[model samples]
Target: MFCYKFPCGEFQTLTKMTETGITFDPPVYEQRYCAAIQILEDSRWSNQIKKVVEFGCAEMRFFQLMRRIEKIENIVLVDIDEPLLRKNSTSVDPLVSDYIRRREGPLSVQILQGSVADSSEELRDTDAVIALELIEHVYDDVLSKIPSNIFGFMQPKLVVFSTPNSDYNVIFTRFNPLLPNGFRHDDHKFEWTREEFKSWCLGIVEKYPNYMFSLMGVGNPPKDLESVGHVSQIALFVRKDFLEMQLENPLVTTPNLDDESTPYKLIHSVDYPFYVDTRTEKEKLWTEVQIELQRFKKMANLSENELDSYQETYKVPIGLILDRLHHVGATKEALLELLQENNLKIDDECVIIEDCDEESEGSDLYELSERLSQDVILTDQEHEEECWDLNQES
Candidate 1:
């Protein structure tokens, strides 16, 4: 996992700002946790997030979660406030940092002190844009600025926005009920009802003709539906063409259930790592073991092949291989045995079996593996002829 540059010193300086000496508000964490849960509820939705842009992220906790997503390429944090942005430059809460830090990668955090309209060139290509609890803060005079601020400028594939319902704002008054008529935000220009939000989203869709809008946390209710109110509506606006293609004729579905003609009928891969190795009978068993072991290596980012070798020598469970790797500490022995188990010919003296280029001899295994993974060049025919039995294919 890549690390976020969270300024510990700056957080120490801002510690006094916490009312109860807790730097992060529990409600903020709750909201973030809930959003993550919501994202996970829809597997397709969770998979769709690649590059993200978050607007009005006070401390960028939401963006931090975006960074955690497995395939995420970039995360851009945008906020109008300078201090809040500065805080994202460091630790927002010391206690929560460690738990969440390992999950975060190096985010492409860009702090812009203006609305989403003024986003930089890098932000315009974001795959998704999130504006949670921010639309209400726009002044009534600048209400039109909302669509003009985001539309072609951000050009996000999906837009997610949430705000409080004006009609159901009474409950939060005592806790935060200072606003007139029980509205959530004191400076909020307008609080929207369910219909009002849909209408607003429709207007946005009209402007961005390719967009499709739907209300989350509404029709498809969850188990804890009683606590949820109409006041808090989460809106998902996806590109209309994409939504139509996905919903109407999803290419990725259960395999051979009915339509056998579809190209991507299987929800998961059958012979994903390699296709050619699955066809032949002689190498089938060996290939299966190799594929599984390769998956383990890739997932764990193991530089040495010791775990692979140990797994082969002992014929142990995947867990045992992992344990031995951890116990023995990753060395060439572990990986070589794992590879040998998968039918690779191994000699005691030939532990360093990799046909290293003369240039990378002194380099570490990790660095060599990285280079080898990218170098797809076919080896010299003479080397292949001289190495071992031509029919071995080990």
Candidate 2:
């Protein structure tokens, strides 16, 4: 097999190789990488990406993912391998070369032959930049150049990138651990834990005054058990100007309780798996659900411990922003009515509901009926009974 130069300047041969002597062909990592790309496509960031550039995209997976959100107007694929670019001409994945070719008229695909270190000027004027599974391959001497070139030159609105969690590789690769810095992998110049990744990202963001960074851990346990706090880290770097403009009161408010069942309707209208894909992307939604539920509980003035049961029993507001979207400017009656309709009872200090206890089956309804009676609304017993029936049950 042809031994490729490692990022550490060492040459290593793969244990297994095809007749063509191609080493380091990992289909598993590739598929998981593609799954990460899929996760990005389903997130709120998808709406912001209209033009895309994939540095070391390797097989055009990120490009394909971007297209699912919107038609890509321009694409630039950069790699050091010219033969790969030539073969990309007929790559089964459309974005490689065929996508630009088949764009129905005068369109051109820009393929640059160079490494990211040498191609900073080329990474220009794009809506989003993706550097997936590319940083691991950069030689240590050239590593600093990677981010500086991209941020210093391109200044794209957003950047989505992923790298190996150092712990993941160490645990899986079983390299020396006693050393302060840990052992090096066969071909990796550096492997980073989530924290190291964040520090580097923060340093890069500091260099550019207009950028802000958010870190998202991308993978699940088996891949990274060390980062149990959050899963894999998926870093998102967005320009501060764009973020401020977008968040200028995104017009989100809490839901009104008594808007003719519309609040209930809207909440229920949310599709099952209120996220994208459950199979591979479940962890992303799980993190989102946890984060949002906490925000909702806080907005409702419920303690963290209270939400332990709340999240299990019912759909809690994912975040106050989302809650604001649901109830902003809503009348107090409408808000209270929605809470009651959902079997959620709110008091001055606590927002609560009966547990899934069989004994409390009709108790909330009975209490709600009494409150309505006191208000001189739903005075008819039969109508109250119907209202209970209409509102209760999922």
Candidate 3:
């Protein structure tokens, strides 16, 4: 076994060797990283993300990026290949070490050799779970079990999943004419079309209603082929129950470190089990929204006699905005700024309300509802139909 320590006290250990030493490379799929980062940056719960477990942390390319994010405090890297895990655990990558030193608090790094099909108790209570470019490698039987284990058993607040878009293989074949008919890599069991991927995710939601998902593409599809697919498709799943509970009590306990019977073996110990809390920046904005809603009745133009009559009427639009604030991954600050901007514009207008017609009121409410749907929920109906075109061609 080999062990290495970084300047920041982060320790890594390698317990296995391959016939040929593993080599680390920078990630070739830059778009996937960009998508993942955008999800994290846009999240209202960004400050709540601290512990992340990566299912297939090959070469630690994406892992390096996760470590650099200011909120992440603990990371568990898992891979099916023991030798590859060993190589990455002991790697002297400058980017990895630099991220460790720059972290604001103690950072724990755990490396494990395992398959996603197998459940690990250590993974429970994590904030965010990630599996990038990994689902394609698993057979369908095994792939079907992953969501249940990750969402139902581990129950992380957020899950970032990505898989290759088989519809985009033609673009790849242009560079490698001799590429196999249906596979990109020798080990890839299947590359799913966008529809198949959506079906699989929808099934997960059906089984686990506590979770909700949004899908996006990583790379740019050709203008003509835009309907077909992008290079990769990603799904971000959020657990609604956890989101509500986290806002009330942000501190969560780490897994029991004393339980040495865990499948994961630690090479270096940074710290044992302890409690950590999400950053309060976003939560503060949520509180501000709550407080501001109470004051809305006072700000709107209403006479002493009219205040009671219009109070509930004025709440309809504000309620729509508040509902959006609850569901959107956008930061509280951004949502608050948007509300303030729209309020300023409304203040500039001179309006005299003679009567509140129920029909007109409903129409106005529907407009706010439509805007919320467009902004908070992400769906590409065109891409879904285009991705299905590959099935017809086959």
Global lDDT of each candidate: 0.48, 0.48, 0.60
In terms of lDDT, the poorest run of 10 residues in model 3 is 1-10
What is candidate 3's lDDT per residue for 1-394, written digit by digit as tens? 0111112231122122134421112122655665676666545677788888888887766655565566677788888887776665654133322432234565677777777866677677787888989998888777877876686667788788999888877765655552464587888888889899989888987877777777876565544556766667888887765445333223234433223223655432243223344747555554445334333433454455664455433432444445545643545356647556445222222211122343674344334344444533333432453334223322
Whole-structure CA lDDT of model 3: 0.60
Q: In model 2, which runs have C-alpha deviations exceeding 4 angstroms?
A: 1-48, 92-108, 119-122, 173-185, 222-232, 245-394
Q: Identify the runs in model 3 with alpha carbons over 4 angstroms from their true place.
A: 1-28, 92-102, 242-262, 265-394
RMSD of each: 18.0, 20.8, 18.7
Backbone N/Cα/C clashes per model: 12, 29, 0
* Cα lDDT tens digits for candidate 2, 146-243: 76556655667777777766665544343334334443445566777777887888788666656777665433443224344222346667666565
lDDT of 1 at 378: 28
Model 1 misplaced regions, further than 4 Å: 1-29, 36-48, 92-107, 172-182, 218-228, 244-394
lDDT of 1 by residue, 1-394 (tens): 0111211111111111223322322233344335533543345555566667677777655543454354554565666666666655552222222332232333333445545544344455566777877888877645665665455555566677888765444433424434564465566777887778878887877766766776743212122433435435677776554454433322222222212211111111111011122354424333334434444444443545576432222122444444445543544455555566644554443322232243665433335345445433323432353233212322
Rank candidates by TM-score, best first. 3, 1, 2
Candidate 2: residue 132 Cα off by (Å): 0.9
